[model samples]
Target: MSITPRAAEPVDIDKYGPYGRPPSKPPAEARKQTRPGPAFPNRIGTSEYPAEPGRYHLYAGHPCPFSQRVMIVRALKGLEEVLSVSILDPMRDSRGWALREGEGHGLDEVNGFAFLSEAYRASGFEGHYSTPVFWDRTANRIASNDFQHLDTDVATAFDAWATREIDLYPENLRGEIDELNEFLYEKVHNGPYKCGFAPTQEFYDTEVRSLFAALDELDARLADRRYLFGDRITLSDIRLWVTLVRFDAVYVTHFKANLRRIADYPNLWPYARDLYQIDAFRDTTNFDHIKRHYFGTHTWINPSRIVPVGPDLDWEAPHGRETK
Candidate 1:
């Protein structure tokens, strides 16, 4: 469980910083240009990357919502002992997400790569380095960084090895889950980024409005049910909870997603707390990483790089959700 801390490999700080954007380019431009890493077939029965305990590992950062989603599913499905994980340091310098010497910040045990980008390069990937990487040790290369598919594959593909019987993506609910996921991705998952990284005033204005409109609709929908689909916590709930958990603490100010705090919403606030009470969701969330990453790394937005200290959250407080 312990990893020796070493200096990260040299990289072009300017080129790799700001999420792999050139200094001259706007944040929005970077968002537009950055593409998800290439996909790798990792199904349970597939020859490429089969479901085998201790054969695969997940490279993740606690601050990343995408990574958090995969981690949540891994825990919920009881794949923690089956699939290993190495968490990167929250702050990404020019060298990108590094493995600092410490207890929580773990080095790349699978490949011993100091920088995450090095792992990408070793796998013959020249694109932007992102986390939630699915590493297949038997092949000595990254299996996938396509987070959306990666999340589901980790949830369902390892059913044979999973200890828990909980199914987040059931066959009967696929249609409903997919529909809700698509809408949430555009409006909630990626909505805050669109607001924070807007290239112009016009763009920010448009995105913030759209983001709030979607939030309003979601809040109304949750007014009756305990979760998105019904009483059970599905993939839709996991996808949306990651965003909501960070909304008041980071997105409200840093991302300018301030139409209203998630706390302001009647149903959404309690719903978030209800999910937070679950160990799979709460334990994966690292507010320290979340706050530091946004405020420290995004110097273009927060030039002073000063992380705020207020906005205290009581996620463990009674949600009163059972009354509904």
Candidate 2:
């Protein structure tokens, strides 16, 4: 059956005007003319895109954990000068994530594009817009939005140009790292979303249990090691850190993954603090963006949209992990 494209609806100008709401959807004519492009190769040495400094740009938002993961890797690998970044406003509407003018949240300086979706459309993607978008400036197209692969590619693809000598994905530990990362991704990393968005009580109950069980296992694992894989941090640590850092503040209440607050976990709490003390992890985290995006935008979960004001955090306090 052929489906006709519906005309765009009139957006509420007062509530979602130029500054407040996302920019209006692009015209139908423009969308139809969007030329499809090839997906960026998994690695950078392909004929399409090469590993060159100052040639790639990352489009990310602070509130998104997926985006946070990529940003954390970028900072850790010292790719600031090698690759550029543009941050979108924390709040998003139906029009999708916006880079408003003069909001001081950083502009879409790469393509001067208004909405993140526009960048996706330009790259021939017609699906839901997502963050941690890897754009190739030289190719004038998006490289990848598959954040799982995107994170590792950003870490390994530019190793020659990376300013830091940290080996996040070491050759010897690849087997262990991949195994643990897959486990964390299913149970802990995406567990809160499953609980929050579940349409049935039975589903929620099942997921919440799985979530806490994974947390308990992680707490036990961290009891001995400072980092996930012994002393040095790895991709697994970065994957888990993004979810843990946001747990007490947003996931506990908003997502109702409230089996217990992350702060209540003995090992997990201190471990989170230890990661936060790192300049890369701490600098990339924006509490304001994290809180507002979850509490304000998820109107289905928070109808009143009244952002909570408690749960004071002390990430700066001594983690005491050095003694362990």
Candidate 3:
């Protein structure tokens, strides 16, 4: 059932890097953490320009962990009115990120191009084709292709225009959040990739070890807190959720990060379920999209390219954390 472009190859990582525009909003106005504590490095890349409603359009694929970061922020900040977003077709066939003419793929609602890669070039972004791209229509150029900091932009920069005040990176948690964020990113977030895309066995072994070490540690950490911090969720949760939700569905099976399923971890399971129950994160998750893209696309892993169908997950079951 493996169905991505790399289904025939074991692990065909054609290219690596965050594929998207540079950054649409500039440094000062775009990324300000509402949380009143220590300042975090600008994770989201910034552009040379300013924030303008409707001037920039976001492009993302729900299957992508990085893209989900931005989507979660957009929902939390209530920037649906101030900014626009386009969910691209998950299935891409070389032409890349295009609608199947009618197979649920819509004509480019923003730039009117059939392929997203083309749209990137159309916007003068010749670098990469990764997701969570911010397109600046006015300049006819990519504002910021960096996917990491898109959340920072939506959360703080748009506060003036947004209908609600949802501060994800609150000041009080900044100090602690900073330390945990580093841990999550290095060992958990990008660890699987290091395992999957490593060129040698030694590389894979190192990455897999680091990856699971972080997970085992995180499982222990979650035994006390409902979220990454106290009772409330923040950007820290959003970052880790992107990887955990995809772990059992994609990494466990494909990347071979099979030490333990997110389901196997007691606290982590409930934490993921709690987050999955949220509309913004839930609606953005597509196990099929993630599965097909990884197993099928990374031909280097499963050259046979047969997608599996056995991990029946019931994310809907109530997690008892709410009562705690």
Candidate 4:
């Protein structure tokens, strides 16, 4: 029993944006304090980016819930021919995370590199050109953008080319799944970007009342669990189902996070439609690149970008939660 260290909470480097909120800007090169290549060998087949089966690639951004939590742990550890992904072009501006050729995105076909800041300057990673970006393609560059440990390193570093080995960071629940994945990344996955990039109005009413008091205490602790550490599915339910599948399609009206809706959470809108009826969280959800990447890339919070259609969400209705 040895644990005592707590007193450091005062970071306000202009209150968010270096890879945090409001269309994350401020890093066009020259910020690197290390990140050039080869650091992320977090075990498995070991050393210098080992775990091979097509030697790593992921870039990801179906509207970035931290690249949909490592693309739902690389599609729940099937590891899609052992860790390969692309899917960028979710409408980011300030010239970042591009690739081109739409329809679930294209280009950057393993470092053809149209953008993504040229795969972070082709290895010499300057800084916040963030995405899922794990890329090593035979040591040509980045091993990780550290999407908070790339969903536990693609759910435990390619477990011998995981064709659905499905552990999702277990080992006796890894200290309560790293304390509910840091309280679901600080009160429910970056708590709607700290109430849509709050820098005023009493800090957006104290972060939208601590983000609906941590989503009303996880909708009463999932009103008797079916997931979030219960019957299966872990990594804290894929980091709270990629922010409840983009909280009413892009944080209820482009990150205004309109007070109440994850369909008004009666147990988190049927636990986010019972993890969107599974297929690795409904085929790694797109929602038109999560509603044109937060209403057309946060033009200082929607300057006539207009990508809304209606609430109109269904997520294929019935989420009975398998008789929880």
Candidate 5:
């Protein structure tokens, strides 16, 4: 028996064009490509996975800031070859995401998935289609979607396969990285998400307060140091960098996370500029994809799904972080 391919329908949900109520459906059920993976459980003792040249694959959607964190860490660690990557379309429908047209994704490059949701199904999950999935391909299933762990896997676990040994997570700076990453996530990473996807005004209000409060603290902190780690870039710096890059692009107008723009923040401006100067950050960033994904796909947020233009920034100019 053959399962006939369903004919593609015009993308009619909404593309964030402007405000319009979505057509009747049940009380809003957040459509996920797959279930969100569980957090890395704390074990009695942990040992780093033995670093190998070719043992893992990183499955990601490029527009995902969480996924970008994993991508940046892999590059900074010089493990591009050690861990192969496959890109899924940032724009997905109810059926879940597939490779963008002519994007030439290897079918389930790790687990041979035609669609990303299959991995979640394979993992026996019934959650959301999340990004930055770490798969142990030889085992033929997802090792984890623990993005924070993704960095640890690349930097600490696969140190043997690392080409340059950049060590984004240095021993002396581990304390600062651990502390700031938590604060940053509360304020910025999931903060914007909570604001945008929030079901009620009260929730959005509280999240908005936390989001800006953290931004103010980060701006003050970065005013003294070159990077968050006091000069050199670290995993923590990279994590914040991905969010800052997207703040103006979609967070401000759409996510309603807009207390202020990155341009308006004093220290944040220079801090972002320094990260933007990095080869990996710039190369991975695409304003088009960033804008299109959130604005175009999340119909509940932006009813019309029309893309907006005009928050142009100056990321390339001289950022005086060195003098700070």
Candidate 6:
């Protein structure tokens, strides 16, 4: 059930760059523009993209929280064998996320691609080329980059081939999961970016306050339950944990989301550590890549491009969350 490949279209790099705004445009006008990710939104297990082992590959970067969500699900669902992944170098330039040969980053094993943009061109897509890209090796195109539901697809689609029996998106919990996903997406997952890229003081003030308020609310919510949905780790936990893991490391200083550190949160801090103790979450996280990408790459935000040295997070310190 393969679809026709599209012709490559011209890309407007500036629109998809760090801030999603062209240089000539005033920062205030950024809100008016929409630089949603590339439009190859097909899902796995569909008629076009069937659920088959070794047919899909993931193109991801450890630094990106969105990409991390997909990687975490892939690991938790035991799709490492069914779906292969390539880790792009964290540092992105004008050309976009690349696969530099000798730099220890993953080579484009599936398509012999140099830059991720090539995948978009090969898929006949045009726009911001972001990860985690779900490549359809069988069709020689990107199966999906719809970050919103990509993790859910990976969580459910390849169940027959999954090495474990984990179900991150259980049928009865999907309604609750969807509601939490929307709330977290608006206030937590994408909050730091809104605050960091805000054009006006008033805008930053509003966004930053809302961001912290949401964090405070989440802290209170987790005070009793072991997870967002109780005993088991669901997609909601993955969504929130990715943000929490990077909050103190990058978001606090880099994004000016410095009202309080996640370390200071009584419940959320330990909960993040609890997830980190799990191999899937711990293995996919790359602190070096995360720090360097935020401080070194976003030169527009930090002109000096100086990567910071000391937040001294003790991720391995005993969380003692097992009883909860």
Ranking by TM-score: 1, 6, 2, 5, 3, 4
- Give a tens-digit lDDT track for model 1, residues 159-180: 9888888889999999989999
Top lDDT prediction, candidate number: 6
Model 2 quality (TM-score): 0.87
Worst 10 residues of 6 by lDDT: 4-13
Candidate 4 runs further than 4 Å off: 1-48, 51-63, 68-94, 97-116, 120-130, 135-140, 143-154, 158-233, 248-251, 254-260, 269-293, 296-324
**Candidate 5 lDDT tens digits, 1-324:** 333322222333443232232333222232211123454322111343345567667777778887888778777777788888877766666656554333323334345466667777887776565777766655566667776566655667777667776878889888878988887766678778777766667666877898888888888888888888786878888888888999988898998988899889889988898888888888777777788878888777766878999687888999987786
Q: What RMSD value applies to candidate 5?
A: 5.6
Query: Whose TM-score is higher: candidate 1's or candidate 2's?
Result: 1
TM-score for each predicted model, relative to the true structure:
0.90, 0.87, 0.81, 0.33, 0.84, 0.90
Cα lDDT tens digits for candidate 3, 155-234: 76667777767678888877887788878776788777666656566666767887888888888878888987878888
Of the candidates numbered 2 and 4, which has the greater TM-score value?
Answer: 2
Model 4 worst lDDT window (10 residues): 27-36
Q: Look at candidate 5 and tell me the lDDT of residue 133.
A: 74
User: Cα miss at 308, model 5 (Å)?
Assistant: 0.9
The order by descending lDDT is: 6, 1, 2, 4, 5, 3
lDDT (Cα, 0-100) at 192 in candidate 6 = 88
TM-score of predicted model 3?
A: 0.81
- Candidate 6 lDDT over 1-324, as tens digits, reads 433323222222344555233344354554433246548877778998888999888989888888999999989988899888888877766677877543335576667777888999998877788888999888888899888888988899889988888989999999999999999988898788877777778877988998999999999999999999899999999999999999999999888999999999999999999999999999989888898878867778886768999789899999988888
Clashes of each: 0, 0, 31, 0, 15, 0
lDDT of 2 by residue, 64-181 (tens): 8888888888899999999888888777766777775423366666677778788888987775677778788887888777766677777788899899888989999999999999
- The stretch of ten residues in a row with the least summed lDDT in candidate 1 is 33-42
